[model samples]
Target chain A: MNFDMILAAAARLDGHARHTPLLSSPFLDQIAGRRVLIKPECLQHTGSFKFRGAWSAISALAPEVRDCGVIAFSSGNHAQGVALAAKAHGIPSVIVMPADAPALKIENTRALGAEVVLYDRATQDRDEIGESLAVERGLTLIKPFDNPFVIAGQGTIGLEIAADAADLGVTQAELLVCCGGGGLTSGIALACATRAPGLRVRPVEPEGFDDVARSLISGKIETNAALSGNICDAIITPHPGEITFPIMKSRCGPGLTVSEDQALQAMAQAFLRLKIVAEPGGAVALAAALYRGDALEGDTVIAVVSGGNVDPAMFTRALATL
Target chain B: MNFDMILAAAARLDGHARHTPLLSSPFLDQIAGRRVLIKPECLQHTGSFKFRGAWSAISALAPEVRDCGVIAFSSGNHAQGVALAAKAHGIPSVIVMPADAPALKIENTRALGAEVVLYDRATQDRDEIGESLAVERGLTLIKPFDNPFVIAGQGTIGLEIAADAADLGVTQAELLVCCGGGGLTSGIALACATRAPGLRVRPVEPEGFDDVARSLISGKIETNAALSGNICDAIITPHPGEITFPIMKSRCGPGLTVSEDQALQAMAQAFLRLKIVAEPGGAVALAAALYRGDALEGDTVIAVVSGGNVDPAMFTRALATL
Candidate 1:
């Protein structure tokens, strides 16, 4: 609701979150017929931007409650982010994850010293499980999105993007972001609105899991039929978050969607061009930027590679697709 | 020779070169029994630190001579770095390369709009070919590592490392670098000497091509028996540069070498842990840091993943090693 909250989050995450580099490639520029700046959050702490929101939410909690514990539900990135942040604060944490989530993600969350509670995406509800754990254990719930502090924390990236763009002498550019519950999108949109007014922020989603794109069009929140099948497991939230949708509706341009093949192709391109690993979900914004070239404006465009916590098998498959 | 020159290069490369992140992993810390800070230059422009030296050398030439053109001899990374920097400066550039170098390197260099002249590594003399071309075309020669401007340019990374380490509260750390002609090693060593006094810089090489390592011990330059067989083609210089070796000898602790298998394993480990692509040559320093645990001192260790211009087949092979 307040842009000041995003600024507050930026101050809080100063020494904690990485001010990830804004990378460009002549090869990618030629492909899109324009300059493209890549914000590689794939290199962020915990291998994703989720750490920003996780830290923001947990750090804002009352000390006694935080000391008690925190509960979260994520397919992977968010779970690890919360686990690591909690550990940093010396607080007990538990994460509810899909049993089918990337093996690397599950292993990483556990490695961060978080208790893992697995549930079946086919028949069980992760939120219900997380909620029950929170209630039973008297733990604070840090929802992946739909939280003010979490949204504000993620908005810090927008501030960096705006500042970096201005530093590069780019006054205006098309900004593409990987979207799930619209938390990252809305947060970034808010920052761009105040800091880099010339940027046109847009949300990008996987083809079948484009609830946010549909919601943006209808001017209301929408839900996906199912959440289990996409290779982009990280951004397959069922719908846009309540707190995030209003902000996105006010600030974002039309959302875009990319096919599974396109996402895999983008992942491969990122490896070849950016020399950074991008998980399926993380590559969607790049996929949109590459495939939806017609929609881009100005000579410069920016895309965020949001996460890189990919399983070896999945990465191998993405590489083979190239 | 002067640290002030490196400071000038940092200024020149301010907006041009990426101020790459200093990444840390607890997993790697547990393995090495020390905290490891990864400088992912793989995310750098041209996918390597070579751009720094290339720009430094080319940009220092007189305007008329620079406008006339430039020529250089390199296996891969330097070629691309020179090509890209030349393109940025709107100057013509020619690169003489080993015909057996990675195909991806050749393709990328050519794609950057450089004229690539391939020479047989076993029979043909690349330097002679480059010299002849430079004389014929009135092109200025930009020696990859031996040039003072180039060394100063590469040294900019040292300034960044020191600043970043200080930000992380790491006053002292063991710095490991992949060495070829020792341009990068000497450059960083110079920066550390003036900027981060507590850092102990060391050069790393492939087992068969430990010319720099051997030279450090003998107090004179040494040459590798063969340059055509190593998987780390980028860092397979016959000997350390005259300008680089003396500086390295004066500042560096000692040189280290890793076997081919160790390099490959390190490449895979980088993929798994850092989620970044590191070429075999680029992964050598990381190999030393991860495996040569006994050699490391202090709680914090910094290793440079210098380049990521690797052929797909080679990367596939490296991944398979995991």
Candidate 2:
């Protein structure tokens, strides 16, 4: 919610979370026709940046509350992040996941020591399951992107980007992020606004699921028509979060969108150029950075690859594109 | 050749080379039944740790000699490393590559601004071609691993491992490195000898092409019966290098070998767990760490995923196994 809170979240995350790397490649630069730095949060614990927010939120909770455990509803990345963070904190976790979520994510969540409760996306309400479980078990429900602490946790990435940009002698750049609920985008925007004023945070979304983009342009929250068809399942929220939309509207730059094919291409390119995996939803920002260059500003663009909890079949499909 | 040279190489690489992250996963730790830390050099420039040695060799060269350009022979990763390093120095580079080498590696090498000279791995001699080209063009021939500067360059990885280990409070661990001509293994061994005395470097090679492992056991240089025929092409060397063998024999721990299946499994695990690409040869060290734990010592093991210049088909194959 505030600068000091983000600093406090970062303090809690110290030694507990990974300081993910900012990577670059000449091939990526050549493709974008500009300097492109990628912050691969996919390499973070649970293969996503969600772990930062998960840990931040869990660690910030009063010990008594934290000991009561945590609950979360996610399709994949957030579920695994919370699972791993809770396990690290020696607390039980209950994850309400869509039955259609990737099998790998489901298995990984369980493997990370979480009790997974699967629900039908079309019939059962994950929120209801999660809420009931949280109440019955006396567990704290950690919202994926709407909570202030999670945003503050994700904002730590902005602090790192600011420092790395300073080291690289970059005065200005577009900080692109794959947007689902605008939590990552808004969080980064807040962090960069004070830490690296020259760097601007921009949200990039899948073409059909560009709710955040539509909201930014229309000056109000927007919803997508459909989401399940897209391959980038990790970042397909129906709408931006209530708490996140206002912060993004005030602090972030205009949003951009990339097609599913472009997202797959970006995933393949992340493997080829950076040797790091980028799950389809995670690579939309990179796709936008590489293909939608005309819509972007500055000579440098920093894209945050949000997650890499990809199924092997999808990964094989991405590699097939090359 | 010594600790000072590695320190100097690290200095030269301060801004030029990527300080690759040492990554880990609870899944990987579970599989290995130990605390497994992975140094993903696959994220380094040119998708391999070869860039460190290449940059060190090229940068340390006399300006007049370096201006004449450099030549090298490689299957893939080293070619790209040298090509990129030479280009960074504003010098031309000539690469003699096996025609049978991965298509991705060949294309990447040429894309890195190197002139490619293809040769038959069975019938033609790459060294003769590289030598004639170097002599004809008054260029310096940068050996893949035999040179002192090259070894010193790769030694920087050991320095990083030592420092990161210290940060993680790991006083002792087996530092497993994927072996080829023993350059990477020996370089790391020499570095760990002084910087992390408790951290013993171990060379891990593919089963059939386990010349380094055989040599270590026999107490003499050993050669592979076949020059080719493994998925781990990056490390299919005929024998250990003259310079490298001595250092490896003296400073490194007992050698380890992993099967091709294990290597591919490790590659898949890297993608599934660590979200990083690791070519088959590059994953051999990780394979040993995961599968050959009986031969290893300590509660912790650090594996260096040496490269990621994998062809799409190979990557698909690795993914298929998962």
Q: How far does residue A130 in candidate 1 sit from its true spot (Å)?
A: 3.3
Error in Å for residue A61 of model 2: 0.8
Model 2 spans with C-alpha error above 4 angstroms? A99-103, A119-125, B98-104, B118-129
* CAPRI quality of model 2: medium
lDDT of 1 by residue, A65-162 (tens): 88999998775788888998999899999988888876767888899989988999899987788778888989998988899999999999999999
**Highest-lDDT candidate:** 2
Which regions of candidate 1 are displaced past 4 Å?
A: A98-104, A119-129, B98-104, B119-125
Clashes of each: 0, 0
Per-residue accuracy of model 2 over A42-79 as CA lDDT, tens digit each = 98998999999999999999999999999998757888
Per-residue lDDT tens digits for candidate 1, residues B71-172, read: 888757888899999999999999888888667778888999899899987898777887788889899988889999999999999999999999999879
- The TM-score, computed over Cα atoms with residue i paired to residue i, of candidate 2 is 0.96
Fnat per model, in the order shown: 0.71, 0.81
B210-271 per-residue lDDT for model 2 (tens digits): 89888988889999999878989888889999999989888875888899999999999999
* TM-scores of the candidates, chain A only: 0.95, 0.97
